[model samples]
Target: MPLHILDRLNHPLWPAARAIYERSFPPHGRKPEALLRRMLERGQAYVFVLANEDSQARLHPAAAMALAGPGGSGLIVDYLAVDPALRGQGLGSRLLDELERWALERTTASALVIETEAGAGKENEGRRVFWERAGFVAPDGHVHRYIWVPEPYAAMYRPLPGREGGLLPPPSGRQLFRWIEGFHARAYRGFREEE
Candidate 1:
């Protein structure tokens, strides 16, 4: 019940959600707010916020995620954040549960992809483990350099419909470039939409 789906970010809970996002992600991994706002306006993105049941709708979200389906398909979980104070209470997992539900039921995305920083550190390993527990598997290959960061990230994916064909066939070379462009291009597209 705390999972509140947002049509746009200009809502009472935005400050809380923004604060959590800022705190959860490092500077380089976070997207520009302007870019996210524009994406919402163009109907290319979806947002969901989680507020503690006791806090109700007035307080900022305890967790939040911003997922985008570029070109009317291909789910990209661009951001997922939980309030540092509220971490380890299973709130993050709950948020992901809601996110996956939306993508699988409300949208037609064939696969859900999450790009994670590649590393050998425990923190990085822990992050991957969390996703793995949720049925996500890191595909074999380097996805790309983070848009703002200089390191290579892995494109981990989970086929949402829960079958072999639910996956996006792995891409290579020119196909990989096109695959990456498909989602990144939408981020740069103008946000104009008819009323």
Candidate 2:
């Protein structure tokens, strides 16, 4: 199915997007709908949905991702989920690739960041594998926890297509450790008041 992506979580798309989001994230994991709208109004949020582009009617949402782009950069993968029935079809990876492309083409983002549950536990093992297979790099000894999320998570990054396949500031690679923590503290400030 052809996908239809919307930069802002606006009308003619909210319903389907909402369904996917609601199903994908738990209560604390999701911001209030009103908060999402406000973020969109302020240009701090982006929602992309895998829609049936062929139809004019409200398209069905197969997969969706919500991003928080602070300062119009440091694109954070707030949440990503595929329709339960559509899992194992590669839609999630495709959607993520599309989001990466969208961020590169439409914004000034330097990299895409996602916080995934990490550890030897069975719960997070598959999640970790999925991200790694999708081209994300998780550094050793570099991990963090979101304020609202109780579990320890590791940061994964896929730099946007840049010069010589390096970060724009050229500092991330040279100072990878500092960049990860700094980005997390700055990007998730609302949830991490003190970080």
Candidate 3:
């Protein structure tokens, strides 16, 4: 039997979801169980888990990303990670397709936006290429600072329709922080104090 992907929040597959995330992401000094719990609490975000039927085992998610609505604009993907073992398997592309489909159904915003590091070396360069292949483009005259990682990254955008007429101005630090704070609040609802 083949593996299938499902929304973790809707399914409440915390144990399986945490396992997949742990396998894909570095511990980074944060407890994996706690992190997964926080991500689940962020009701605004969606987590897709891939599972295999044959073994009745949730295949560690080959790829994962988080989405949030920022200021009523389209969905913003906060994080995207693919399992190291499955990098070239097309899982990332499939995961993105799911995100777009979900966004199209739920919002009137004309696009989905994300950020990645600039000059991020080979690893991030590959990620940038992946985004490009998926139809995303860099906004004209706009550069984003990706502060979560060790190094900063630039922001990228994928216009759905009608959004091509204009570009959202880059957010100021304070504004960006407020937006992220909302996202964090939702994402870490139950784990806020530890986060």
Best by TM-score: 1
**TM-score order of candidates, best first?**
1, 2, 3
Roughly what TM-score does model 1 have, to 2 decimal places? 0.80
Question: TM-scores of the models, in the given order?
Answer: 0.80, 0.76, 0.66
Please report the TM-score between candidate 3 and the true structure: 0.66
Report the lDDT of model 3 for residue 28: 67
* Lowest-sum lDDT 10-residue window in model 3: 1-10
lDDT (10s digit) by residue, model 2, range 40-126: 665656667776554533445445545545332356776788866567988889888887787777777776767787667876999
Per-candidate Cα lDDT values, in order, are 0.66, 0.65, 0.55
Distance (Å) between predicted and true CA of 122, model 1? 2.3
Which 10-residue window of candidate 1 scores lowest in summed lDDT? 171-180
- Top lDDT model: 1
Q: Which sections of candidate 2 miss by over 4 Å? A: 7-10, 53-59, 68-73, 163-195
Compose the digit string of candidate 3's lDDT tens values, residues 79-159.
555555556877667776666766667666456666665664798797788899988776543444445656555656676
